[model samples]
Target chain A: MKHLDRREFLATSAAGIGAAALAGSFPALASAADAPSFRPEKDAKLDLLRWTAFVPSDQTIWDENTKKFTAATGVPVSIQSLAWGDIAPKAALAAQVGSGPDIIMGWNDDPFVYPDKLVDMTDLVDNMGKAHGGWYDNARSYCYDQDVKRWVSLPVGCTGNAVNYRKSWVKEAGFGEFPKDLDGMLKLARVLKKNGHPTGFALGHAVGDANSWTHWILWAYGGKQANPDNSIAINSAETVNALEYARQLSETMIEGVAGWDDSSNNKAFAGGRIGMTMNGISIWYNGKKDTPDIFPDFANVTPPMGPVKTHTVSNNFTSAFVFKYSKFPNAAKEYLRFMLDKPQADRWVTEMKGYVTPALKAYAELPIWTSDPNITPYRDALASAKYDGYNGKPGKAAAQALDEYVIVDMFADVCVNKMAAKDAVRKAETRLQTIYKRA
Target chain B: MTSRSPLLARLDSPRVLGYLLITPAAIILLGLLAYPLLLGIWLSLTNATIGKPGEFVGLQNYATIFADPIFRGAALFSIFYTVCAEFGKLILGLALALLLNQQFRGYRASRALMLLPWVAPTVLSALAWLWLLDPQFSAISWLLIRLHLIHSNIDFLGSGWGARFSLIVVNIWRGLPYFAIGYLAGLQSISKDLYEAAAIDGADGWQAFRRITWPLLLPITTILVAFSSIFTLTDFQLIWTITHGGPTDATQVFTTLAYQRAISGGQLGEGAAIAVSPIVFMVVLAVFVVRSVREK
Candidate 1:
């Protein structure tokens, strides 16, 4: 549970710094020297399906990296960027029909949904782990299939969530900085609302924003969807406590947050309607470009500490998985390796302005985290991050509960529907039981 | 010489040619509609998830979904949505049709303008409605506030009932033009002489409409109602684009639920079951309406 301060983080990343040094001296040579090479098939071509990123530079740099890969290796790669919500159905259909883009950069637990259909990336992952410092434990949880004893996917990175608030507004609300604990957050929210600037969080079926903070709050209150044994264990006093807290929190929010999706809060924040919301760095990035007047007034910080006094993990994690049905598997593997290598990943992360936190531990020392003091907190976003299932295994059951927005709805039912906390907990428990039992 | 062959001669026969003439249409229907419908139903009866061919479970998926509160809510909501939207569209469309049928100076232009909602893409229109209903940035809210009608913005999609009502309103708004245009065509086809005849018998406008117009329009109304009911029951895009079935799933319809479970959740069988659950309602409605129209 120890958080590494900036100084300590930099100090502990000696190995990462060494890799950076090598990359600086001979970027091409160092990458080629350490990577486990794959000989692409004759005339191998790859098609990659990726979600459209929130930060514009993420895609621009990503496409540039892919072009670099093609220039280095004689293989041609085509990338298709789809909306965030559409990728899941497309990936599922591709998995079901046994044909699609050779590589899919899918969201959390997507590889778990169709483990058997994905290509085994064990060697590629092991080599990458060694070449970099190592993959984070959370990334391993996402990409590795414990049942199969193989890595079914390679984690690309995660888009971490943080509290984005107007600095001036926080000061006006009688806070020096954003609150760091549950009680303080509630007080700050109340004050902000009184000051005519209420905080808003997505209470709807937002795939990213709602799930991220809701899960964080639930887990922070020591509630979980299931136990280590994967049993339904959500009907607990802790869950009720979480629900009650959410109910109190919702009262301090803008009027329509319950119906808001991922984009709603962003618009609200940029339009100066809400004082605070949890989101990725896209809001700050986009605000800098479009709303320069408001840009200096806002700041980003880590999510508030719950009563448990421990930081809980929450993020919109992403990973890449190649399907077994792919005709050019080696080429796909090579392309992933080429993109995830330090030389390319460093640039992508740096250009993204810390929008995407690296899944590999080695990239923690990337300049993006240090250059901007505002983006410093995001560097540790995945440090304590865990997979979705948390206490249980990450699998279809967990993914289903997530896809159905079980936890988000549990909090929302109490917050927006004004259902009794215990009743909402019972309802969520039943839904989770149905999903887990079915799975 | 070629036509003298027995097969060619048989093809020239009226019965054989009649079958041959309808072959393509039948094949197309079977291929496009029947095949997918059967596949979906078949999938529903299995334990199919994504990527794996599943074993038959024999309606177990149906039992599971029926017991699910979310699915049950979606089922009830779909029915409510269909009935309410259809009635609203029918009544309002009939009114618009009647108004448009009048010989106003700009009747042609007004009719064309009225069709914009239906003619515009559903997704695009729904997106516009999303902005219009936005709790914070809504133009309607701005107008209402400026008019001093309400002191605050209406949280259109914030609560369960609010979201449900908003979705139904949007559905009606988008679908009204279809009903209006169809009823207009039906109204125009009615003879002006019938009204003259009713007047000769001392019938008022309402009485004349009840006696003549209602009877003549009943057939078209039945057909329109049947088609609209089916479309509204299976409605996906408008609700999905607007809410994604949120506010505790107040507006979750069968199509969205099916999509969430089957496509997003990767439980193809369960999703298929949810998708096909509305077949009974649709079929029963269709048959009853068709039979009633035929009898009348």
Candidate 2:
């Protein structure tokens, strides 16, 4: 109230603000005893690196949820978004340099690729599992390392892939409804091709679509990359059969499936050029937004069953890793905790338009799945979904093999290059041996 | 003003001043170029992956890559891509330069417009090309199909030949301007008196171009081709954006293969080995360029 000089005024204001901030934090400090196990360090700051979601709305929801976390807890957060393909290399480089985001989101087997550099998030995993129903088997297999006896990552959700098709076209292709099995699907695809609405899936080096579908086909035909002992098992009769099946299917596909990437099929399906393709729900979500006319014509079904099994691979398993070098491990865990909290999780599911399939079973009941019947198949497909490494654990070797596009290339050799299935399998076997033989 | 200081006198020397002027550039080159180059060479000798500190494995990575079929395929593709793209660019650029060299209306504007493909960022233009060559809804495919020139849509980036052809066409498109502008400068520098003298000597257009223009432009062409070859061989963005060295590794080049091995595959050592393999060819080309430019 007295007449004060400029320096006096500034000093007084600074002290007052500092006191108010300290006072504001007193409740949090006092409630330490009642604090959640994963509470962040006092005044922690965090950096999170994740891939840019295919659905812009999904990213928006993620941003909003992070903002909610920052509002609830005073910890400011910075999010770095990268292209999906760039995420692994960026995360790996960061891990190599030992200087990067506090938390990094990557696909399956990413944590295993740099297990020594990632923090053991066992407590965080146990807490999330206990809080939300329980961890899905696939998620547990992806996150947990038996050798180290620790969870190096927290499995969030998978970007579910299903058969995205033009239902009207399917009906016109001499099929009253979407094909329910592999044989029927192939027959429908042939008819669609004959009618100039060919079904297509990537046969090239698409990390997501091509890899996922190729693996599904391989497993469906009882083909496996390696045995349980990690011995080479790629060159089998089952693998040959799978390749033969894929080659026949490729004959019915668009001319360029051999060179298509993950987005090609999505673009084809959305632009009304292709009859059916395997893709994440974002394709439909995108069609609904940008191409409303084409959107209603689109429908989805669970990936069809093969003779041996009804399994498919989910390429979009979003897993988060807190590096050992992070200055705010507690904060990273706390953020995940807040994100996975039931109410927040439900809102996220709705906001993402069910693009993200829950890793926790309880979140399956979120009304978003039932909101659109087309999206329900994605939820149902979650039951048979497998990560990149199917019969074996998702390890460093699996990550390397997937990144090299070995499986994708193996199929392309048969379908695109006209290599005999036996020869292609032999080549893939040698490549797999080279990859898995390394320590 | 009265007596010069020793330090100032020494600094004022032409040699010292020249070194002083270049010190910043030297430092930048050492830091940005030399250091990384040396680091890459060192990394190639080690068994580096993502996080762990790699131990030296001598020439093991090189040996492994040398034995790899993919590496061999990529090497062959890189050579083919470079030679074909450079040859196409040279021919098209020369034609453009010859046409532009003639006195014509709006020549300046035409010259400026030619730079759009070259001046635009490679990634942006490549994305545009991606849309143009899209297998399903390609504008070019639509045009071709409409004309009944082809039975169905040409899979521009689908098959081995299609992807290779698309890559080369895009490369030529992007690189034509550089060659044209470079050759235009060379063309303008040529004395008009030489053409007049050739005409007086009864040399026809082809003879004049062959005798006068060819000899005069040889040095420039040699340098341009060498440099362009290096650029085309090491090109990553254009190919990475277009095909990602796909269609069964049909379009794989050294740079894309290096990226796949080092970054995507996380075999940093092998990736570096793949990357370093291109240096031998580039070094020979560099020598040729330097020798040609130095010869008067």
Candidate 3:
């Protein structure tokens, strides 16, 4: 057998890796520039891959705008839409394999996970800063890459999780308005349950769905998850009361609500089964096509305070990053600039209707943005919104290790089932401690 | 005396050639299948999460699986689902096969349609079931409610019993065709002469079937039972597509739990551990099946 020399093979592979690294494709540097659709001799080609579904709200409207932008400047654009969950693996693999898309959208929270894979857009943010009035703090915080002292994924829509209620149901329940606080919510839930409209914070197995629960409830009760110091403050009196309130709410809920995941709740609400729910308005927007009866005269409000504080949490808003594999960094910045521009951003806000809130402040001045009733509340909420993990260490492993859904379930076991709240909290806390310690 | 070198070399020569011919197959097995299996076994003892390589933590994953209420519940639920589902399939498939085997006009055409449910993709079947099982739009439940068989619409996938019962129905539906086809093959293999001999011995149709038909089908029965047990125990696709071990993890099986640990919770090591424990049970069942069948 002819054996290969280990030293030579290692040396050759290292060199190849180094050469690939310096090539600076994905996870390296520079963004891709858009080119003419039909290869024009004068223009350069660029690709834009977004970690968001290019829905009617932003991408389509941008396509119309891109036509005009192309009319003036003869470069072409290609847009790739993907789910946010698929972004990192795609980006990472594209980097490793040397064939990733040029410009990809990521949530502001994404830089923490893959900072090296993106260009430091701090200069881009600073450069683009004058053109835009301001950025939402929560959305902007996640885009900054502290490692390189620059911004990464440029902020787009700013969303805060809120309670979406049916105006028709509130009136039928003998309530003049949406429940303003925890007590009001409790009272309204009991009223609604008695009146045939059961209410609940629909629970199920989805991990991101669990985060929405954590932010609106856990944070309200002072459950601090900021690490390297995870204090299981979720076991306090305020939290116990929150859990108790959750339990009482559970009692007033429809029988099958415990099994409802996000889509299931959306179906429940759309069918007028659930009186209200806590989740993203994206579901509400997307549901209209299939379930039009579901979206009528609905009111979106800041998640009500639980006798403590009404805090908002969103898993993330749509975000983008210039991949290291980019062929044209300058072109990517230009596209991001165009994305933030007036009729473009406003059209996204208007067309997406209520699905997204524009990251740029001045878009609120635009006609379509201001005129939309369903979308306006989200704009107001983001003014005071704190991103669930904005600016913090990714702390994903720690938080995951804690397994918030399972923890919340355990807590709910005590709170709703009257399984001894202290015992439940203690078990959950011990679990949290073990997770945090391991992390 | 034979020359030592010539004799020794000849002993090795043909074996080396045989190994050489099988080299590609061996390499592929090692690289693709065997390595992953061994790696999974290794991972089961460790505390590996996704993306992060983990430290070995002895039998902690197995211990935790037993200690966790969720796993214990899932295990019992899985066993209940498997036993009920397999038996239901066996009974239904056998009955269906018997009916199809009877001489009748248009029986050949109807026999072909029976294979559709078995052959249809699990995802498509699940989607069909999802529609039929929806509380508001469920065709079956709606019919039952309309006919006053049930007072109100029952949430078929909500309650534990409802979900388990629903799984039994689906599992039976999916597995019936295999059993039916297997029984048909077994039935066809039986010589008509034996039945003729039984009839000549003053045996009635029922008595002939009991003595001649049942004994002949024994070997096939053992094979079918063993095959169905393994297949049913390892079943994941249909139930996952239907409920994803849903509403309360009420439909939790070992596979679903393993999936949650691996994908949802990102606990690969724990999942690998959970995934493998079922094999021990399956192996024991398989051995018992083979041993009993062999003794007969």
Candidate 4:
């Protein structure tokens, strides 16, 4: 830290030279150019960069409702389907290069990680708060910096981990109800393995899995990363227990569990190699629609209780960001506000089925969502889920530590039998402190 | 400046044309290499960002990297990987070159086939290896299983050792062909009369190769080894596609670490520092190699 002075001297000298050049040109360009102000292209024309899995067709839709969304919303979602994992880096890169999707559908942590790189919607939040009948308060808070007083993103959807089971398999295993505790769950797991039902999990080195496993166990032990102060406090007895239990679970984990990333796990759950795993309603929704026979008799419920409480990591709570470069701040906010409206959100969830459960109360409270079995638990889990540390603008170092480094290498190190639970946590903690300090 | 006169005129005739010929390369190098190098050195002393240019922070970035465990691990791992890769490429490539230089059946076809690995784009080769290393669908794993060479399938990219081993093998495979071709070309350029003269003096094939061929090829080897060291030191794709420097810091090279630090960590200054650290050594090694080869 002490070295900053000398470095600042040399750097500032050069920056001053560059700044002179930039200042000389920028004001001239701004004044002469036509971009003094321009509104976003908001003609009720919504643009969505959909995930690859969400794009369905050519297989014949058995449901008539989806056909109607296409027909009615002639807003015909210019659906560009990208692999979900590719969304962040691609979006981040595009945002860096100054041309990205008007509306990119991604996972939860993006808004926090890319907040400054996004549009602030305080006015939109106000207008849409009333416009959308006041979105679920928790969802709204997750999408913004409540303390900073800005709506960094609009909560479009929500996802949460749950006890997804092959209802038929559990019935045959002589289990009447889902496992309520760790011991019961292990006993059932053993019975299932003995009966030739192999449990599989996808612990791939992806950001989704990073959050997924953290939430799976953190909530399992009734622990949270943030205290009331929102500081990292994950290292605790409960977290350690979850770590040990996660390792033990790794032993009984099937032969090819490591090979299967997100897709493989979805396939395992659907194809019957795995009876029950913790996942979002999207797993079931995707399965039921794509591979109907593999869907099986299903159920979604709370995950097993640790000594603390039974909770699942809340998911699907994505925050929408407006980049600082957006020519139309009002229009961008307007577009986000439109997505917040109950009818639009309801139509989205209703059409997409249970994949993206809406975060807006107006949308969640709709009769369509209230009646859906798969989406209901997402609503319930939102009450207790914890968020990782990204203050709406996730940095590269923090991003690497969380997404590329920590989860795959550390958590999976224990989860896949490479290292002891305690050692992995210790190693990760040491590395994390250094990385976080730099941040 | 006027000392040479007419003698310098003839040499200077080609000099003007040579500069013209190399001008494009110089410009490209300046933009891609020189500018980036200067930019990195500049940024390492500051907190320059993608979205915002931050205030300068001096040598703190370098100090922070030294203090950090992950950076240390990655740095150490990079040295290990580079050493292993360079040795593997040299030894295996030389042995293959020796074998291929022999008079054999389909000699031209065999010689032509050696160029395949060197010619393939790195990204494609890495992608292919990813498939072959796939635990579930790995053709190699399937063959190994059938031959009873192993137990169940191994997750080549899942464990630290497995991931590192996979990268080394892929790099060796890609590196060997180029090495062999370079050696083979060097072999062809050598005068056959030396070998004949040695044979007339009662030298066997081994002695002829050792005394004559190896000595003459020293120049080539010096150049080859140094060039490969530079290439291997900065390699980003092979490690990226194979392990992404993963399963931990096992396969993380300096270049990959620099990228992860910059783009993913958003510590552009730190990343720039890490990226440029290699240049100090790289420049020294390159100079040494050029001088050593020239002297030979």
Candidate number with greatest DockQ: 1
lDDT of 1: 0.87
Chain B fold agreement for model 1, TM-score: 0.96
What is the DockQ ranking, best to worst?
A: 1, 2, 3, 4
lDDT of 3 by residue, A102-192 (tens): 7776553444444565666665565445456777675555666444566777777755466777778789888887766778887988888
Compared with the true structure, all predictions reach lDDT values of: 0.87, 0.83, 0.65, 0.64
Candidate 4 residues B1-296, lDDT tens each? 65777755665788876887899999999999899778879988987655556788989888988777767777777767777887899888888888888889898899898888889999899878877886566789889999999887777766667777778788889898878988888888888898889989999988998898888888888878888888888999887765666655666778988877776655678888888888776787688767866786
TM-score for each candidate, following the candidate numbering: 0.95, 0.92, 0.78, 0.78
Task: Categorize the docking of model 2.
Answer: medium
Q: Give, for candidate 1 chain A, the lowest lDDT window spanning 10 residues.
A: A1-10
Superposed by TM-score, candidate 1 places the C-alpha of residue A55 at a distance from the truth, in angstroms, of 1.9
DockQ of each: 0.79, 0.64, 0.28, 0.20
| Best-fitting candidate, scored by lDDT | 1
Candidate 4 versus the native: TM-score?
Answer: 0.78
Alpha carbon lDDT of residue A256, candidate 4? 49
Of candidates 3 and 1, the better by lDDT: 1
lDDT of 4 by residue, A1-439 (tens): 0111324433543454366456662221121111111223334343445456542531123122223332322223344667665666666665656776666765655554455676666655655556555656445556665434567776665655676777777778899987888778877777777777756655554345445755566556754443444344455666677777777676666664543445455656765667767677767777767778756577777666667664555454665666665444444444444444443445555655555556655555665455757556655656555455422233333344565446446557678656777687677666655665565
lDDT of 1 by residue, A301-396 (tens): 888778778777689889999998888888788788878888888899999899899888999988779887779778878986656877787888
Tell me how far the alpha carbon of residue B78 in candidate 1 is from the true structure, in angstroms, after superposition. Answer: 0.4
Residue A319 lDDT, candidate 4, scale 0-100: 59
| Location of the lowest summed lDDT over 10 successive residues in candidate 2 chain B | B287-296
TM-score of chain B, candidates 1 onward in order: 0.96, 0.93, 0.89, 0.86
